[model samples]
Target: MKRNVRLVVARLRQRLTAAGNPGLFQALRDGAAEGRSTGRHRRVD
Candidate 1:
């Protein structure tokens, strides 16, 4: 669980392309922001 969070944070950082930006942190704070679900078929939103 810890590793996954770290990886997600890393990817968020990599995708972040603004100077002195902190969008990634905000996104992380907003739980269930975006990600793939591991289960039966289902439509999000």
Candidate 2:
């Protein structure tokens, strides 16, 4: 399951790069960082 998540993130990174949307990609990174710092985990489902 963890591996699958990693794969999805990797694919997203690639697509974001290919699309030339650094700002959006950085936002995602920042959001993830914020979640980690706040010790909060959001469920997708």
Candidate 3:
């Protein structure tokens, strides 16, 4: 199970690099910001 997860992560890294992102940190930050912006449109419990 751990090995499968590692392989998936490695594949993701390769794809991100191929797409020319600096790294996952920037991608995650941007995603978080996007989620937050969209969340403002919904009611929170």
- Local distance difference test, each candidate: 0.55, 0.78, 0.64
lDDT of 1: 0.55
Tell me the spans in candidate 1 whose CA falls farther than 4 Å from its real position.
Answer: 18-45
Q: Sorted by lDDT, highest first, which candidate order results?
A: 2, 3, 1
TM-score per candidate, chains pooled: 0.36, 0.69, 0.48
> What is the alpha-carbon lDDT for the whole of candidate 3?
0.64
* Candidate number with the higher TM-score (1 or 2): 2
Name the better of 1 and 3 by lDDT.
3
Clashes of 2: 0
Tens digit per residue, CA lDDT, model 3, 1-45: 778966875777777778887566456546656768886423323
Pairs that clash in candidate 3: none
**Sort by TM-score, best first: what order?**
2, 3, 1
5-25 in candidate 2: lDDT tens per residue? 888988999999999987787
Residue 39 lDDT (model 3): 67
Query: Once model 3 is optimally superposed onto the true structure by TM-score, how far is the C-alpha of residue 14 displaced, in angstroms?
Result: 0.4
